[model samples]
Target chain A: MSFPPLLEDLIRSLKVLPGVGAKSAQRMAFSLLEGDRLGGQKLAKTLAKAVDGIQHCTSCRNYTQSELCDICANPRRELNGEICVVATPSDVAAIEQTGHFQGRYFVLMGLLSPLDGIGPDELGLDRLANLMATTEVKELILATNPTVEGEATAHYIAEIAQQHNVRVSRIAQGVPVGGELEMVDGKTLGHAFSGRKTL
Target chain B: MSFPPLLEDLIRSLKVLPGVGAKSAQRMAFSLLEGDRLGGQKLAKTLAKAVDGIQHCTSCRNYTQSELCDICANPRRELNGEICVVATPSDVAAIEQTGHFQGRYFVLMGLLSPLDGIGPDELGLDRLANLMATTEVKELILATNPTVEGEATAHYIAEIAQQHNVRVSRIAQGVPVGGELEMVDGKTLGHAFSGRKTL
Candidate 1:
């Protein structure tokens, strides 16, 4: 059955969400309209507030309402001049969830994809360079993904940090923790063997 | 890093959507706030409009912005005295997609689940009674799901329609059209054999 104009519009708008196709968008729209009208209202308000209020952190490029994100604003995070650079805010959250990284983060917001018109400027590489030059940076941790673009972006960032005499380290690329050696890919296994440490 | 208040609230509210967990909600929030602010505003307006505008169709209990849904309002749909009774609006959409059934539909909105406090009143069986009393309904097609609750709901609806001298017919239940003989379960195989059609 054909839906009303507003509902059709709503379904179409819902499709803007990543991974939501026509069928999923219809389901979500119907579920919200039928089962959870209040929840739908809350989502609407939140969406409006987020779009209107949230902005990029001046220092790290992470999403925030203020000029600086919580991490950048916190004095505790500035204790050491160590920074972990990542491709997305989700990666920052993943690292934060582990409660392991104490230093601040520099979010690239995206990888350096020249084909997609996303270059070092798109990734705010100049801002990263400025941070490295101004701060008493001790180490730069390259925590981007292990994809080809990730590797290239890491190399580019490393070059910038090296020019400024900042030590650079990359997150290990090998068999994952608790991964079976037999199931490891040939390239990963080769890297694991080559990067092996003395017992 | 802790998200700002608005971003955090947006992420939490996003979890209200079906299948969205904390991480997915966070990702959605960030994507909207960072990448698609205008899309986010559009979604918000559409969501609010949908929630405020859509209502149940007075005749079939299907979702619509007006008193009568498209099917009920259409003159072509009222040519026959046949009504397909199903549980939800999705079922109506599924039936409509096939384009086989030309008759109107009566959406129960939900099946009979006494455990969940959904009884005859909740399914609007009285409204079905009212429709039978007023309309020239000749046949009441029980097109509910083939589950145990569906069977019970169908039977209950059938009894009500039978009392009004309306013929009751059920959609066939057996091995699916494309199902393999070996893969078919015992009950379905039995039904398939029992309900075999003449050549």
Candidate 2:
């Protein structure tokens, strides 16, 4: 038998989430309906609020409720003149959690994927260039992840920074801080050897 | 930096979903806010609709918008005199997908967990007894999971059926159908041996 109209619509709508399949969607539907009606109401209200209110920061493309995100609006981050270019907003959050980088960020919003039609324009490279022209950005750190598309995106952004005479540096790729040498992958080991630093 | 108030609230509300942690909730919030605002709106509308409209079926306690759930409303399922009793709506979905069971279902909604303050009334065992008394039920097949609480719930409901002189049967427990015997756990192996049928 089929679910009632609204229940069916809810299950279908829930499948849009990443990693959630038909079975998982059904499980989530039952969980919310059977156990937490208040939670469901809260989720609905929160989702509506976020969807209606949130917008991308004009300066950095990160999600924000105002014209500028907190990081972009911070006076200290603006003066730092160090912009870390990342693939997505989640990457911005990851770097922020580390508390090591005290500068700003530029969210590319996507990686370069020729097959998927995500080109320089799709990654908002032109917007990055415009931001570079308007600000006293001294350095551009390419912090895109190490994959084929990520590498292409980083290189593309590096070229853009070079055109603006801005110094470009890639985040070090090697053995992670606490990783075991034995567990490190072959390509990373190779990069570690080739990009070794002198004390 | 912390998320804005609405975003933070959305993330926290999302955590009430089963298996969603802080990181996952944040990701979901960002995904909805950044790229899929329409999806967020859809989810919100659907969730609100389901929560507000859906109600338990009077006969089977399964989710429904009408007085009776689809299964209980169907004349064919009602006349079959076979009631498959399960602990959750997901179980009903699983059994229905198999297409082997033509009879109706009785959803217990939860297992008997005395430690957590869940007892017979919480699982609605009295309601099951009432349904059995009123309906032309010939067999009560206990389809609860293989966990301890599931077992207790099944036995409790079975006793209830027995009190009304109704035949009660538990779904089999053993090594899974395609599972290797060598890799099977001891308790399941023991049940497999004890419940062996004549060749």
* Top DockQ model: 1
- Stretches > 4 Å off in candidate 2: A193-199, B75-80, B97-103, B134-136, B146-148, B171-199
lDDT of 1 by residue, B1-199 (tens): 4667887799889888888898788778767776788888999999998899999899999989899999999977888778999998889888998988998899998899999999999888999999999988978999999889999999999899889999999999788888789999898899888998999
Tell me the lDDT of model 2 at A123.
78
lDDT of 2 by residue, B1-199 (tens): 4566777888899998888998888777777776677887999999999999999988888889999988998999988999999987778877888898999999888889889899988878888899888878999999999998888888888888989989999999888978899999999999999999999
Q: Per-residue alpha-carbon lDDT of model 1 for A91-187, expressed as tens digits?
A: 9888999998899999999998999999999999999999988987889999999989999999999999999999999998789999999999999
**Candidate 2 TM-score, C-alpha based:** 0.86
Estimate every model's Cα lDDT from 0 to 1.
0.90, 0.88
TM-score of each: 0.89, 0.86
lDDT of 2 at B144: 93
DockQ for the candidate 1 complex?
0.61
Worst 10 residues of 2 chain A by lDDT: A1-10
Tens-place lDDT digits, model 2, residues A57-82: 88888878899999899999989999
Clashes of 1: 0
Residue B107 in candidate 2, Cα distance off native in Å: 1.3
